[model samples]
Target: MSSPTSSRAVPPSSPPSTQAQPAGLWPGLGLSAVAALIALGINHAVPTASALLVAIVMGVILTNVRPLPASTAPGLAVAGKRLLRIGIVLLGLQLSLGDILGLGWGMIGVVIAVVVGGLLVTEFVGRLLGVRPAQRSLIGAGFSICGAAAVAGVEGVIEDKHEEDVVTALALVVLFGTLMIPLVPLASTALGMDPRDSGLWAGLSIHEVAQVVAAAGIIGPSALKVGVIVKLARVLMLAPVMVWFGLQLRRRGGQVEGKRPPLVPLFVAGFLAAALLRTTGWLPASVLDPIKMLQTFLLAAAMFALGTGVTASRLKNVGGRPVVLAAVTTLAVAGIAWSGVMFIG
Candidate 1:
């Protein structure tokens, strides 16, 4: 004979305690950490292979080969979200305003144009091919900005993004960016371009920072310096672009679960603050070096977490449209960048 209100009330013991949350996260986090360490080892052995790429690929392979335990979910979520955001913030430390501004106004304009133009062209082509809006946006962001990192950043803002879209976008970044590593240097030699021009082209057109570095390294030290700086300039655009995405989602009345995304996500703000800190020359190389290593490991771990979501079955359903879109955008950006290089000269 309990009262109606008392009968309806749930017992306190039924709800999981907040204290248990940290313990629950450890299993998955440990798995991701192990995978990231393995990826680092592989990258150390093969200097040409990117640790992020290696980590993601390993995650994909491991998950597809056999499903992960349910216990890993919480940790994986933290890796994908929190670790990824922190890594992105640390990424800003690598960029210096002085180095980018040194490229001159014309080069700066080219960098902006490439990011904007590439995004537009990718969206147009994606629409023509009947690609889904979310997937297309992800692909466009990845190619136009900084590859997989851009893709991950955009995914955080978009309320309706699927894990499949992220996996597809990342795969495209790896496939097309890798192809450009050798092709760009060979093309530079064939065109008889100087190191500076070649570096500009690589920095502007290549999808990933690592790929640009590899390409520029093939040309010479001067090219490597210019290429890295130009690539960082593109990385700087991630903040504004992510903000734009969040605003667009707001306009559409999109919310994740019941919560609307912020106009500027906390992580994006952190990224900007880190960049300004780097620009101030407050941090010495000794401090920056360890931060860089930590950033890389965090990013690699997050990529591995994201990669676990990719399965062969899901990828098969993605079709060939995205592939065509990637190829078209790759050429489009490369052509636009080359034209800018010639004009600036």
Candidate 2:
């Protein structure tokens, strides 16, 4: 099978050494993520919504100060992605038929319809807003399903190298979305939706699961749990959607279009298989817990890979198109997510 590629490209030799000793994975990044947790207090940060905010801000700042190149083994990147997907599946442990049963059949239809509908609307908006192809791909994927990672996964197959445009775009979406985590709950309460529907809207609409859970927890734990289940239903679509898009790129001559490409990711397949296992009930909780534990490790490793690759030189002014594209597309997502929540909730 053909492999996926990254947006970041590497040089033949080394570019001028920005630092005397450039650690492959920034030496203190773990410390910094930990420090962020400590400073914010575990009550609020860590993997919660606020943690993503801290991570992205720190990541961008680190990018400007010491842009680590994410030149890791192609194998590691592939393994990292699959592990993340499995972790997502383990998230299923938190759900069962009970939550959906409580919400009733109508909520289920609403959730399903909105996710399916939103994907089409977001894609059209991205294309119309003239988001760069890669940025368009990222924004569309990020909004439609999981953010950051989803964009990275699909882009892994579609693009040949990690151009600044892609990273810059991902950073902005993550940055802006992270910053917006607080507002979602406010909007939810203001709309006067009940906790059941409120949580569904939160999970279905929020870009990241961490964001959904955080916002819902602030509103209430029941909301948090229900929202997570809603989010997973959306996550399930990543593989089929990516496969469809990947076929288009391969048809377009894809990375062979010319460039020193990175390896294509095979995790999408793993993700699909895991989902199938979940559907078939082949993996019991006995095994799922270990998988979840493994995912936690992978999430940290992938973040490390993503962090080392970040650099401010590319994120610099970067002209205006990418930023403009992200802003417009994000606003576009907000419109869709909000309207869906209102009508469906």
Per-residue error for 318 in candidate 1, Å, reads 0.7
Query: Candidate 2, TM-score vs. the true structure?
Result: 0.72
How does model 1 score by TM-score?
0.92
Off by over 4 Å in 1: 1-20
Instruction: Residues 1-345, candidate 2: write the lDDT tens digits.
Output: 111133332311112123324343233334433534432454243546344334445545654565334443232333234434454444444344444456566656665565555556556665776655666666667766777657656655666444554456457657656655777678777877788767777777777767777777877878887788877766666666777776777677666225423332356655655555565666687987776545544443444334433566656746666566655555555666556666665
User: Tens-digit lDDT track for model 1 on 1-345?
Assistant: 112133121111011223447888787789889988888888789876888988888888887888776666667777877788899999999989989899999999999999999989988999999988889889988998898889888888886666578888988898899999999999989999999999999999998888898889989999999999999999999999999989999999898535898999999999999999999999999999999989989989988887877778878999999999999999989998999999993
lDDT of 2: 0.56
Please list the Cα RMSD from the true structure of every candidate, rounded to 1 decimal place: 6.7, 6.7
TM-score of each: 0.92, 0.72
Best by TM-score: 1
